[model samples]
Target chain A: MANLSIRSVSKSYGAVSVLDDVSVEVEEGSFVVLLGPSGCGKSTLLHAIAGLNPIDSGTIVIGDRNVTNLPARERDVAMVFQSYALYPTMSVAENIAFPLKMRGLDRKTSDEKVVAVAKLLQIEPLLGRKPRELSGGQRQRVAIGRALVRDPRLFLFDEPLSNLDAALRTELRAEIKRLHQSIRRTMVYVTHDQTEALTLADKIVVLKAGRIEQIGTPLSLYDDPDNAFVAGFIGTPRMNFLRATVADGGKTLHAGEASVDISHLATRLEAGRNVMLGIRPEHLDEKQGVTLSLAVDVTERLGSTSYVHGMLPSGETVVAERREDQPRFGETITLRFLPARTRIFDAQGMRIR
Target chain B: MATAASDPTRHFFQPIIVCLTVASVALTLFVIWISLHDLSLMRAGREKFVGLDNYLRFFGDPRAMAALWRTVLFTTLATVVEIALGLAVVLFLDRDFAMKRLVRTLLLVPIIMTPVVVGLTWRFLFDPATGMANYLLSLAGLSQVDWLGSPQLALYSVLIADIWQWTPFVILLVMAALESAPTDPLNAARVDGAREWQVAWYVLLPMLRRALAIVALIRAIDSIKAFDLFYIMTRGGPALSTETLNYYGYIAAFTNFDISYALAIAIILTIFTNVALLTMYSVLFPKSGER
Candidate 1:
């Protein structure tokens, strides 16, 4: 296991920069996930660390060595590609045993290691099957086995579960978490799936436009994002943002027919300043202290929880989490905001501390 | 032509087989009728039934046996050498280079040139005293070599010309296969600690095995029936060193005027070539259950 330190790493293709001076510190035996939307350079940063894609600048320090210029094999990093990338010609055992064989390990020992990895990944019965003969989930397990058999210093995963079906993705995601638990190696994973990042990461690095937006624990990032983009990107049924103008001499925010009192807002703002008030769906309650009201337009029930989508008089929609029942479309509903949980971003998108 | 209305997509084999069977039966009847007779160009229409005499006489002829052996040797050598050399060139030029497009275009010149042109060009180049081959030998302080005159070197001179003309054909085929093969497995091999050569041998080459087999099959078939280069360069000269089966069949019909025996030789050569190629194809692409 090794701690990975990426310092001022930047990569560009022609004039377009893909990773602009991105840096992250991952502790040994921790799982760090780079989470972002498409074209956000999370995959590029992972490739840079793996040495598959060379960085244009900066150094990558792993353990005690600076391996910035080392080739992928020389760096002792094994990758699980999104496509699985198994050798189609080789059987599962040979695919898993390849790295050990390349390192010149004895056949007997290598075979034993292959069996151990196969058992770990629960792919022991598939040892004789070619990759083409295996299903997507089975291929994923074999790819993991290949990476695990190497016992590399750091493991890099490039959206390894994106291609699988939902059930299989969840299954593999949990298995990967367990693998990290058992092996306790430093692993850096890249994915655009926020749920996977929230579930699998010890530290989540949120990225946007080739730059790091925030780096923190998953809950910290979800609860306290650094900017409007980070706030918008981290959660599903995403954080609701309402354009509000300061009113009542810097004491309240007014938007359409919904007005939220800003008297207890953590940050002081001058009167007439414009800001976006962000709140999570579950935080919008009918029985909380600070409150706003909007007319209910639509609602959806997902068994235990319900999502209530309401519309302001100005024709803007806002979602709230309700229980059991929903109001009619024409009915007005009062939603109280948890003052401690609400976030405000300026018109320029900077977080209002 | 007056058959009932039929769905075009659903029943294509009926019409196809009807046409194919008519053509096939007529051709087979003609070949078999001629093979059973003592036909010759000089004899005209005074032909008589000879049964299996022509086939038996062919197996007994020493020249015919030697030509058959020469054909097999030439086909095997040409196919193997051309594929190996072509693959080597493809690998050498696989990477980015300043003049890659121009070089690829230039490589096509050899393949697109007519076989007769290639044959005459190599013949001049192999001229004993004044040709470029001997000129290079002189430059290296060696004696002028008889490239096509000596019996031992005559077959090889024709073989070299065949390779020079056809290796680019293999290169073009294998290059297209290489271009479309997925590079993810190869990149994964590099990340899995495989060296450059190991990645090529284990991942990249295995991926091209099917394409290489197809190119080898084509080159093998082409080599077996090759006559233009031999006619242009050697013409089975230098004590019959390059007298291949196809050329021997030519000699039987035109020079010896034994039309029946030449037909027999043609039939036997076709069977041999088909059997050999079928075996090769089966080996390269075995039945899925057989593995």
Candidate 2:
């Protein structure tokens, strides 16, 4: 396995920049996820790592080699495309064994490796079938088999499970994580799905408008995001941000009529300073010290837990998880925020620390 | 997209199709009947039923045999050269450029021109003494070569004219296929360690197989029935060297006053074309049931 290092990479199409000055380093044998919305250039970064896309002025290094000028075939990398880009005319075994054949491997060895990869992917039964005859999940297995058979320095996956159904996506997502754990290869996966990033990545490089927003571990990004974008992008049900003004010598937060005790904050606060108080849904419970009354707008029941989307006394919307009860719509529900769970950001969307 | 109703016999034919079918069937049956007799327009009403004599005469005639072989050679050469040259041009123009649209529009000029007009223009260009071809040869310090006058070079001259006109047709269709082909597979091949040439030879060209086959089929059929160019440029040539099956049949009826024999050749050419096309279709598409 090899570490992928990208330095000051920038790419543009005519007037529009697809990837701005971006730099990220992925540790060897670690799963690095590039997460972003559409048009955010996460796929571009993944392509650059695989040498499928050329950077404008950046250097790409894989292991100890500077692969910035190398073609994709010489880069010692294999990629699984978003559409599972299987060779449609080839049988499953041939598709999986293409890289080995291209490298001039003999028939007996290639066949052995193909059989091994097929068994590893649980696709041995589909060895003789064409890609067109396989389902999306099976096609994806063939794609992954193709990449895994090469024993390359790095493996890049560009949303390989996005085309599958919801059930298949979850199954394949978990299987990919398991495969990563077993093989311990340096893999860079790109996806817009936050759950996939949180579950599959050891480190997620959140991107926005072709720039890196934050790069941290899954829990670190979810618990301590660097900006309002990362704070909002991570986690299900999203985090709520309320505009609050520091008061009482930075001891309290005044957001309209809603007040919060901010004395336990990690960052020193000054009086009259404006900041955004970020709170996750699960952190807002019914039995915390600092209590606030909110008018329920809607309650989304997700079986074991219910999300009470409501407006605080300050007229700002907040989402709180009701573990033991589901609040009725249009009714006032009392929710509490733990002071330690609150993250504060300044007006420019940067973390308050 | 039109499907017949549950009753298998009803076709729901449009009036135009109904008229076309009746005309085609009647003409075909009349042609077959005429091929069995000596129905000469110059000697009307003195005709006698000849049965299989005309067919036997056509097979045994040396001129007819040479014409058939010449047709096959010209058709094979014209179709293969047009496709190969057109593919090269398409590959050259596949990338984006400032004047690409104008260039593509200009390519349609050759295909849109009438074959008779194209043939006439080439006839002038092939004129031995005052042709542009000879002028270029003289400028290059080479002797003025007879383009159409020499029997050896006459067929190839017509073949060149045909290639110049129809290669653009192939280019237009193949270029469209190249444009519409998904680029993801190509990129995937490269990322999977395939070189550029390998990618095209192994993946890209195979994807264009059906389109190329259809174009070859069309060009082959067109070349087999090509008579206007031969009539306009050479009129069966200085030594009948450029005479193809279609033109020879025309000459048989119009020049030799052998109507029955000409019809026999026509019938034979039709059967030959159908069987050849069917064979080609099966060969090109071995697993068509999957598609």
Clash count, candidate 1: 0
Per-candidate total of colliding backbone pairs = 0, 0
Q: TM-score of model 2's chain A, to 2 decimals?
A: 0.97
Top model number, TM-score: 2
Q: Considering every candidate listed, which one attains the maximal lDDT?
A: 2
Candidate 2 chain A, which ten residues in sequence have the lowest lDDT sum?
Answer: A284-293
Error of 2 at B162 (Å): 1.0
Off by over 4 Å in 1: A247-251, A263-267, A328-331, B1-11, B96-105, B127-143, B289-291
lDDT of 2 by residue, A176-262 (tens): 999999999999999999999999999999999999999999999998899999999998889989898999988898776667887
Docking class of 1: medium
Candidate 2 Cα lDDT to native: 0.90
Instruction: For each candidate, report its DockQ versus the true two-chain complex.
Output: 0.60, 0.76
**Proportion of native contacts present in model 1:** 0.68
